[model samples]
Target: MKYDKKEPETMDADPMRLLVSAILAFTVMLFINGFVGSMGGFPAFVAFTLVFFRIRTRAGMGNGGMQQELSDRQITGRLLWKYAAGYLVLWGILRIAFLISRVTGWGNINGASAVEYVRQMWNTSLLEKWAYFFAGMIMFAFVLSLFPLAVIREKVRWIRYALVDGAVFALVCLGNNGVCRLKFEQKSSGGATCLIDHLLLCGRMRTWQEITCLLAMVVFILVIGAFVFSYASRQYAVKNIDGIPASAGEEESRRHRMIRKIVTVGCSIAAIVIVVVIVLLMPKDTAGDYTKVAEFLTEDTRMGPMEYGDVVYVSVNEEADLEKNGIAQGYLAERGERCDSRFYQLAIANLLYTDPTGKTNLVQTAGTDGGTYAPVASVETDKTWETDDVFLLWDEDWALESAYSHEPTGYVACPADLIQGLRMQFPDVTYRTADFSDYDAYFTLRGYQNMEQALEEDPVDGDWVGCILVKDNKFYFGSYENQITGICLQQLRKVLGGNAK
Candidate 1:
């Protein structure tokens, strides 16, 4: 079609296409990065940024529907290959590892905790169904990748582009396959991809409030979409109109430039907010992921599982049953808000059948082979266990022995009676004095370095210990050998129905 001689002809901007593209990218990001947390997540984030630029440029340069045609393939190539399939494998590995760990790792010896882990891991049926649906879709997509092979000449390019995009995604997102893994050392792994992942990966879905990441993502889309809209429309105006006065064309170009500046500033602000939100909400480490450690602990290693160990992890996520699992949301107890040991310790205690409803006051005692050789204060908090929270000292004298180190009051509520009672309950499990080494050994086995190293670098936060290693019927004070966190305390507290004081 031709334009009239007097006025400049304006072409309509494809707002729908831009909007649709953003939504598609957002959904792919959530599916690939948000819930599943694969390495592809950051690349997917980068891809979304590129998608906006491509859509606008193509729309401005095209006549009719050409913009949508070629670009849509890129979407298929980018989303399905870069983000979807990558997360599919990672997410499946996590789920399968969880199941495998349950049945094989701890289940082989600690039958009691095995049941508890399985029951707690699959706590919500609805969430499990959603997870299952996600898994099924991943499988479907994987199969779809093969369907093109059946009719080789027809859709082969689609698969080819997908693979090509995937390779690009890996190289760009991982700095050519150089990931820092799940271990954090308070030092940047020193690469561009590491920084991007640090700034962009969406937070895992733990509580409902983590939806902030989604809001951040949407804002990102809208900001980019606005720029695309204005640019496309202005380009359309320049191209479709002919025989217009030079001044009018100059005026249009000038206005477009101004709009571009405004949009650029707006986009910059939005990008900053997105980065801030991402950093604030990004899953810091892979500690919540225990599937690797759990599955591998069953195998013998060079340094007895600690050598060449890869314990980096993703969150075993859920939004339900936060209370039933003794999340201790509304309960009055030790404020585990700041202490790493306290958080895991209290969480386990809250789940205990005995201490689930009890007021707890037991001390963490150790004689030697632990750390600094000094004992922490006795447990004088409102936390409990099935039988006890954490047990270390076994001898009555050691349990009763006065300790000079502790918090605030400097006096510990020595649980001599509690130790004797616990000892009487399980007389066969030889107990040893415990310390940070137990937790240290645990983290070390999973490639965490050690307890002190973790505490120094990452501090107390999410998923301190992934899977509790089961000893072959030996109890180190209140924990076990090669134990770190008190997650193994579940073995004794499996029958808690009352207070342990």
Candidate 2:
């Protein structure tokens, strides 16, 4: 009998291809790691492992083009030990860091004393926490670096792969941190500046602790990659012994195959159902509130010849009437002067009169003997206008450079005293102040312009002050440069409810 002989295929050991594949796999894993809680990490890791295996197979890296030439028993034993070790090391590091942070008074765990903090930490189920930590890290390592490390073991030196993998992981960490920082700054600053500028600014402002923590994280990641590579490489080197059969491409029994098929179909159906439920339960956008307010301002006959300057005259009576008018218009007017007038009126009404619970009251008072109303309220000097509910005052300047030109520019300043008084009066209400320059950011964040055009014209130089009222997590803004007088407050109070002392 003649036997046919086939030559074993030699795997392609392209360093660049391996490096790129590792980067892409890890990048995707990082992106999707926290997608659906810790469980999300498992699928991402599995996907990466599969990809790593395919890459190795195509390159003809191991026995029958597999990354590891180990028998089933050897592979299982090695994986269990590596996973256990990785989990223990990572959990220990985290626990140590937590303790150190507490001892140093940096943890700020509800202002607990060091003893209390330690007690609290120890009181929790450490085993359970460690179990979770281990699970996450084991999955992360397997998907992120373990498989890749094993594949490269035969082709490249372990030390070289460790160094290369560690460097790549460190770079990924830095890039991810930079991206997150940029996003946070954008949200805080309302996207006023470019991401590069924000990154540079934030880099300069990072505290020593922050820098240290970042460096430590990078080192930790590097160590993990190195450790995984070292352990996996050793496991792959082990020769098959008696009673330990190869696991790759082994034929399965009919029942086992049938069970596997059923499981796959079940998981697919469950995933589809979860997606459908999530879509159905998604929260409705609150942009419609701003749209409703805009519509009420434009179409309500009670708004009666409203003007940008007339926002000061808005009262509870007009407010109630305006709210009653409901969302009558479909869209806001163009962003010219007319748009500004409508915006101010709508903002004022929304701020003063939208409370459905009647917890707020507007009181009218007599005019101040001698007070001037200006378009912009000056923060250079002490000035106070008493309202029934609170005293409104502005005593200091808060300035910022222009986001567009990077030149010194003015911003609307809210008086600290006024804020304190308002807070005292209505503890539940939230107050935010914004300058004219911040209008775009403020409006965009609030989703105020459902169909309103961007304000193309430069903000009026003297018109700098604005007040934002936050109730039930909803924002309402109103602003005027004109100095508010006792008489003005009285008239506004009369419209609101009654006389102010």
Candidate 3:
């Protein structure tokens, strides 16, 4: 039974209902976006999705539409798939916008040229472009609106609707996209300098940027004006209560069985994979948080693999600065927390009692665990260093670059009391700082430019370098922190204590 294409049949569903719902949904969505940020738009989007799809697919089926042939449950099942597809489309739009910004180095003060920028960022990470998340909802609403009308006899007509909806969405998104903003480090004379006040930083744009910005603005205006024209001309939005073109006619399908089977198998595979991933990610709550400080104390732990404790020391500077390497975080590791911070000040303060030139001032550090710090081991020892436990230091210390570095290093300004209790508990093996002149001949030097610069610049942040031990008799040198294990530390303490047994 073929229906003639007079005005293509109709349903009692309110034609203006979609427009009203869209205005309300998008208004609420955009308003809430400011409070919750871009991510918060998801729930608002889903809410809008559910509301809009319910109309063409199920709610209006009662008056006269093809969807009336299915039960509410069947209609709901179909609507959910439509909702999911629409979500993917919206997500893709946002991802593409974010990709453009990422590839172009948007908002980065240190942005390089496009080619170098893309090369550097290609392997890095993709961050969200919030404009799509915020303004893209208008386009997404129109996309969702098209899904229920997929079965219309004039199927090609949906393409026209999509084109219009997409134009509106894209235009709205342009105002917020990175293209509309200034990115380079160039000084802005002021937005008022441009005919338009700082829209996409017209005052700061190079010739090309200006051309692109103006072109986009012109296109956006034209497209938006076109929408107003289409609406005014009754070619869009103004509609008759026509036949069931929007899910208007019920039809049978020979491929229904095959499609259902495929969907079931696909869902089953997805469910199993999801369950496995979730189980694998579940934390082992029963595991204890014991950390052996000896584990990571190596020039390179990879040389002789250590099961290295759960205490991975991240950089305090690194945690603060995303660009720098994270080697300095050892100063603040708590005892039981994952990523233990310790050893910088504790080791430095342990140096000499009277040298007077050390850079470290024992500042009370707050632990990552949100607790007051205390020194776990004291540097005070009446015992003389008759054994002469000498150590070579680096700021990785600015002292490593000084003339005094060639002389016997002495500790200065050590704290009588220390912070977060310096979590590392070393055996009583007394030691003193010594210059690297002791091993300049034997050591292989390969510190990076950034590391060396950072080291020479800051004296207090000496955690960057490992402590090299010199036996002093014949230039026999080794790293104290890297080479010494828990087992070796215990043996040295016994031999030093004269309890060889």
Candidate 4:
């Protein structure tokens, strides 16, 4: 077919493709970088942007003439080899940086975070990190090079592309190879996957509303089919006898026109119904409705095991059934909102538990010896524990026997066992317990004598002590050897829960 001079050589560019590519690339990179312990995520974003532009340009060329004759294997192979070399070269530089850190004691490099592969280092060579970062970008570009090939070879590339895409997509979505392993076998380590597994367990099945929406969608699809079929049938009939013009065919033509008009009216109504049904099928977002910490705690049967160290943490509240408990201690309680420790405990617990629905798994406790620490604001208190029952809290008015040199009101709370353990395991600091009748006495003893004085002191100056809330009760513990954060607390809570706490 010859094209008219007025016709454009190619169709307009599809912005939709670019947008989709960008979103998919970002989501994949974020997940991979978070789980792979590589700083390649940002680079992957860069690679996707470049590839999107390149693809859009190539798309304008269309699959005609010479392009159509090219073999899929040859096209894909050339593209893959070209970008792979670029990516590897970049990765090579990052590898060198990693090797240097392993040998040198100068740079303070922290390993991968829970979410990304990028190592966080303080006082380290920024240039080196950047080198590795760029390498990740190159790798992503190489991966995306095959996107075009997959699209063009859709019929034959199902198995090939599906395998490749599945691996990449799973890794990107789940964060780590561990997750991917669980996805395929449903028995890797334990359970299906980590976060996804727990999410599925917590999430509800399709409700009646969702089912109704799905039914509506089916109806809409059926209507669309019926309308399209009728419209097409009318057009087909007209086309078959469209040119005949005579008295004999005149009556037939009139009859066909009336039928076509009726079909057109029916099609229009069906089209409107389809659109309305589709709109109704869309899902809506809603806010989370979780109870507050204090409220959740006071509820009956809230007691849960929290295994930390060698002992399990049992609830110390009077309401809890404490008949067989061996120890008990009370720590000043902080406001529910200020207690960030419990959230961290939950996050880590999800990571540690192979079966989140209270299944057994043997995971080593990091204990006081194993932890990532950073300076933070906290309280101080001391108490002896004869039983496993423990209570942790922060009193706004609680004061110490001696003032925390840097701050007026700081306290630590733990049962006698933990205090003794801390002393035996980590003996540099002194530990003492304070008994305050109420918040006011607690602050007065700590030297914060007044709330005004407490406000003047820096919150982060002292050793890190904080509350870790399990299912209902709070356990107050102190660490002198390392710092504890909300993240570590969550992991500890999960492990401790295994011991029937």
Report lDDT per candidate.
0.31, 0.35, 0.33, 0.33
**Model 1 poorest 10 in a row by lDDT:** 365-374
Q: What is the lDDT of residue 33 in candidate 2?
A: 38
Candidate 3 per-residue C-alpha lDDT over 353-465 given as tens digits, one digit per residue, 9 for 90 to 100: 11123232121222212111111112123112112222122322222434356541222221112111111333243222222223332221112223333334222222211
Better of 1 and 2 by lDDT: 2
**Can you give the lDDT of residue 328 in candidate 2?**
30
Against the true structure, candidate 1 reaches a TM-score of 0.25
Candidate 2 lDDT tens digits, 401-456 = 23354442322223335434433433332121222223322210111111121121
> How many clashes would you count in candidate 4?
47
Instruction: Name the candidate that leads on lDDT.
Output: 2
lDDT by residue (tens digit), candidate 1, 15-94: 65456445545544543443233423444444543444343333233232233433323433333243334444554565
TM-score on alpha carbons, each prediction: 0.25, 0.26, 0.27, 0.27
| lDDT at residue 129 of model 3 (Cα atoms) | 23
Once superposed on the true structure, which residue ranges of model 4 sit more than 4 Å away at CA? 1-14, 30-40, 59-74, 85-164, 167-501
**RMSD in angstroms, all models?**
19.0, 20.6, 20.7, 20.4
Ranking by lDDT: 2, 3, 4, 1
Candidate 4 least-lDDT 10 residues: 435-444
